[model samples]
Target: MPNTQSRLQVRVIDIHGHRGARGLFPENTLEGYAYALSTGIRTLELDIQLTADDILVATHDFTLSTAQTRNSEGQWLTGTGPESITLTAAELKSYDIGGLKAGSPYGAKFPDQAFLDGVTIPTLEEIMVFCSDYETSSGAGSITLNIEVKSDPTRPGHTDRAEKTVDILLALIEKHAYADKVIIQSFDWAILDFVQDKASHLKRSYLTIAAHNGEHATIYKGSPWLGRTQCLSDDETIPALIKKAGGNNWSSLYKDLDEQAVSEARALGIGLYVWTVNETEDIDRMIDLGVDAIISDYPSRVQRRLMAHQMHWLGDC
Candidate 1:
């Protein structure tokens, strides 16, 4: 194991609460986001999908999951029921995603999550409004938003096209004047590329996971989710491809990161942000690696580690 007590001589690594601290709160719900903010997390990492009516909502999955959402009638959604792209915002609001289904495999993963009943998936606009209001009322600084566009090219018709998704999200950011505070990110390189081509002023983060064999293999290829690979070179590392895609930051699966890649990414001027890290040991390891940010399901855990080393980003928060 890496030395847990050794501190890296670098700037404080920002703690990005993944899905608003998914291990403790309902992922992507306003309630969860609020709780994360109360915990002094200034940066929030979330996912966005288009509703059937073309409204953008903060949700991780393209469809409602049986493990975390229940219908308006109060029954758990089963077997990947309706795609968000097929349901209007009003129709999508009919489900309660405030709590996870008990004893389900997905719920089992977040054993410490505090259940909050009657919470619904919130629109991206709603979240932005809430954050703006929170900053005003609490006198805290604005929250940094890392918004991920949830698009999968392999699953045609399941979500909006990459261009449309970026346009909608960019419009929302412009409407709220959040362009300066938000970091647009996605696993889909096409989406990042489009943002680069159009809204070059806004920051973009490229999210990646290691390539898995068979059905999930596109993760490591040029663009697994799309029909044609975009700037994919089998010989290049994920970070290199992200830089080529015009991303300013490289968000990688924490487990897939290594020292050489981290060093190379830094050399390329791409900020390194690792995701979903929860354990203290893993947290320590990431800190030792001198990553720019740690996107974790348990931001409090990261906070404590930072505090122990006197490297907390928010300073005594």
Candidate 2:
């Protein structure tokens, strides 16, 4: 475990509310985002996917999950729903995603989430504007948006090409003048590579999930997810790859991180942000690891943990 002094030696650990405090509110909705901001979390982490009309919306899944979505008639989807790209923005918004269905296995995961009706999907632009509006209305601190592009290399047909997705997202970021306030990320390294090539001014987080449930990891050599530029050596660490690829940050699965990886990232000057750390023990472990940021479905839990260590998410706020 790192002492408080050693912890502060690294960098202030940013607490990014994953999908806007998914444990406390519905995931990826404006309502949830508002709750997260109220907890004093400046970094808001959400995912984006394209609609049939080419509008980018803040959503986690490429397809609708039966767990939270309700059709216009107020019925829960029996199974998986259509790809987000198949629905027009207005068509998608007709469904309600304000709350999880009762007695659902997925709903069981977020037992404490507050249920709110009539909440529809918000566009990426809408979310940004909402945050700005919130600041203006409340005179609160500024927000740092961590936007993840929902592009999967394994399922290339699941969404549009990485280039097109990057272009659309970059345009919105530029249009909103949020280029400096956002960190663009994707599991598809091709997306990050495209951002690096064209929008180098934007910060990019290389999101990597190591092998789980017998699935292949994205960091391995020759993985299509790594894009055209990655011809990596077999033993290349993920942090090293981030450095070589000119990434501003590396957002990784919290379980896969260890002290060695932390040290390597620090030595190489790469920012480390771990995702979805919810349990108190896991949160404490991440805190002790001296990571640059912790993305969690429970931002308040992380905030408490940081304060217990005589630390916090934002300084002078």
Candidate 3:
């Protein structure tokens, strides 16, 4: 960790644009990223999925989602995800993601979200090139890429073999020559281990959930992983599990953390990075928690909040 400062002065920071600023724009689309950078945010958070042609594309869900996606046949994907077994990038591009599930108060939130026809899914390589070119042109604040490898053990062989997933993803990241400006993170610790072995220099951040992101969700009634539903388990109270999985950075849920939790993570040699923090109060509370980084859907707000804090490096004189 960097030296502790009495005044908050972090020249470099980790404020990730969750799903390219999902709250402001359509989630996971290139337009969202463009908007995020416009807000003075320095980094983007993205998700990856493997196509049938072994290409890695930027996506949130394994299949299409009603929130931001439609099917290849001009219809909404309201059914089982298992049916989308063989969607190639080209094939998946036929649908209109921006058209679906509209007219509700949900769409009212972002009335300005642009809609484009025939906009296909962008491969990870494409996103990399976009970021690279943007950096070259803008030359403003340095931007970091937080690309999540959207793979899981439950599906087992749904996307690609572990080796193949790494190969395609690593190649895409290397293709744009963004090896340095990237932070590879994942829910699957197995993927993190594989990434660490492959590129030792690569920075790794692990995701925790209720039990994972140092949040209470692990003990919540909704979680299937709980030891006994309707009753919180003693295992849920253990902080070691989060420390062990967080590697060097503990990215936990926002509500489940306090100042002590932040200090505990630091004490365990695990720094802090909280995820998916969207609401205003949540953002404020997390800021007070003094995490190393906080991933939020609204990076603009987080940036503004951080700028208001005191900076020791500037000097009080």
Candidate 4:
């Protein structure tokens, strides 16, 4: 265990509200973000999917999920809806995403999630602007956005080409003067590589999942997710890969992390951030591990954890 002085040495935990506090409100909706901002979570983590017309919109899944999406007429989708890439921004947002289906498996996962009516998907720019305005009005100061660019090399048709997607996002980031406040992250290393090659000044976070029960893991050798330029050696750490790619930060599944990897990441000067750690015990363990950040669906729970250890997410600065 870390001593009191060592624990106090941590200035801040850097709590990022995952999908705008998914456990408390509708994921990735404006209302959800408002709730997260009200809770004093300065770092808002969100995902973006490209539309058919090349507009970037806020959403998680590749398909418009039957779990959370409803048609313009307020009827819940009977099955999975068409990919966002198949619809224009206006067509995509026509579906309501403010409430979960009554008996959806996804809805069951977030029992406490509050529902709102008539909420629509906001474009990435809208989300950014809303956050900026919120900061000014609430005096929350500079807010950090962890924008995840959702892409899959294997599923090429679901969205636009990675290069085009990256270009669109970069344009938006530059136009909004968000270069200083954004960390462009992606599970697809190709996207990160594109950002690194094009806008080297921007921060790039390499996202990884060593193992998940059903999700694909990108750390293995020859994984398409690592992009064309990167591949794992027989003996190499994920942090080493990120370092090689010129990334200063890495986000991984919280359960896949161990002490050795954490220490190695620190030694390499890589900021290790864990994602979606909602349980109190797991959050406490991450705090003990001394991660650079904790991405959680329950920002308040994470805040309480920080307080329990006499620490703060905003630090003492």
Candidate 5:
């Protein structure tokens, strides 16, 4: 690993637009992505779910959420609608996710998000095309795609098998010639393992939250998505687990990371990227930790924080 001390001296933090600037625009919509791009955000962080026809679509939730989505009939869904896996691409596209329900608790969370109408979910291919077109027209470099594969071992049949999901995602990345610009990330470590074996050339990020704690502090005994328990020992740390699984980066909930974890990851040459760090204090904390990247709903906030420290470095695709 390079000298952590030196790395801190010349901080060049990468800013990833979370769900395409969800706080400022409709989450996961094409318009939202466009707005994020306008803010000079080169890394577009998004989630992907497989439609019934096996097409990859950009969405944060596996099921249609009533909080932000409206049905084809233009009525707000009372509860969770059909799962994305059960709907074809065309069927999934009919639902509008442009705006959150007004005055609801969900809408209150993103008070500044522009409320738009008639926005539909964009497919993975569609997003790639948009990025290509935007770069061509604007003369900006290509944007990096941080694609999170949404999967849960506990929720069987809600998503494709890990192997199948990786195969399909890899095919799309190859088809778009995006292997160099894509980072496949997942909370499900099994998919990371599959990618390591199947497409070692592609970059992978291991995502973690504070779900596992206390007795289940170690990933081996804590993470339910790892599938098998024998791949790692109960005493292993998350950074060690990520390295053993062939992940190039460790993406964790900012609060769950400590000085020790950051030092361990840096010592192992694993890049650190913290998620959802929106507030000024949290952004400052992440920067002080010397993380490689910060994924946030407000890229502008991160940019501002970096600017204050004279460490803001605009990244190309």
Candidate 6:
């Protein structure tokens, strides 16, 4: 059978909880993931940072971010505080990243998110347990974990090398027995290559962010810019560039996407997943795009929108 994760039956597609629905909950915390599933998101999109000892921990920031996390003493970190690579898994566990100014357009909405003291950064093992148990309790489908191994090939001696990062993540997920339940992704295509090379069974996505090509890049090789880097410019089209840059699978910003683009991508067999959208309108737009899946901060909003829109669509049909 075809992969069920690739599409919806009628209207739209799966909703991936962006860092565990950062706007409604906390970014990249177990609480965030749980709350997102409770609110009806299917996939939990999170980042995995390896510590000094190689424990895979779910968090978005490369450093201990002051805007989103707090120290053991209950003081919120205000800037790029501690580098995650330097801290051990034990020491890293003492910090909590419950409430900060969430992010753009969202920070203004969720004003009173509770700051839970003594909440530690969760290991991949912990998150797996949470999801497995959550499935039993909530009857949700096998929850997908998109763990971006945060390693840069150029920036050595920072996090693990691409190979080691993939190794740590693959081992941890295997220990949890989620080999078929995970999709590993990264902006670092080298890491993607590494993970795909190591574990060919695991679904992999190559992330395309704003690259730094000098002029608005033309067709580098008559393809969208997935691997061939582009200059990060607001003037240029990122999703189109990513399409031209091509890969096995593709992910882009929700705002930069449209229906025609999605269809074009799908015609080429490129699976579409967009990022970090939190509003109902954008959620509606994503459904219209017929995207394979979406990463959003308010998974609840996405679910509600899809459910409601489907009913409306059925009625119209």
Instruction: Compare the candidates by TM-score and give the number of the best one.
Output: 4
- The TM-score measured for candidate 1 stands at 0.91
Candidate 1 lDDT over residue span 89-200, tens digit each:
8888888888888989999999889887788889999999999999999988889899998888678874346788788888988999998889988877678777888899
Residue 151's lDDT within candidate 6 is 62
Pick by TM-score: 2 or 5, better one: 2
Q: Per-residue lDDT for 1-317 in model 2, tens only?
A: 24535534534679999999999899899999999998789999999988778889988888898889999989998867888877899998999998998999889999999998999999999999999898888877788999998887777564356678788888988888898799998888888888999989988999987655136577776777776657466567888788878887999999889999989899988988999899999999998898889999999999888877778687552
Q: Candidate 1: where is the Cα deviation over 4 Å?
A: 1-10, 158-160, 212-222, 225-233, 315-317
Clashes (N, CA, C under 3 Å) per candidate: 1, 0, 7, 0, 0, 17
Cα lDDT of model 6 by residue, 71-161, tens digit = 7777767646888877899888887766664562344566645555556689888899999998888875678888776765445574345
My TM-score estimates for the predictions, one after another, are 0.91, 0.93, 0.80, 0.94, 0.92, 0.80
For residue 68, model 4's alpha carbon misses the true position, in angstroms, by 0.4
What lDDT is obtained when candidate 2 is compared to the true structure? 0.86
lDDT of every model, 2 decimals = 0.82, 0.86, 0.65, 0.86, 0.84, 0.68
Q: Rank the candidates by lDDT, best first.
A: 4, 2, 5, 1, 6, 3
lDDT of 4 by residue, 104-144 (tens): 78999988898888899999999989988887888868888
Candidate 5 local Cα displacement, residue 259, angstroms: 1.1
- Report model 3's TM-score to 2 decimal places: 0.80
Give the lDDT of residue 164 in candidate 6: 81
Give the total clashing residue pairs for model 2. Answer: 0
Error of 2 at 163 (Å): 1.5
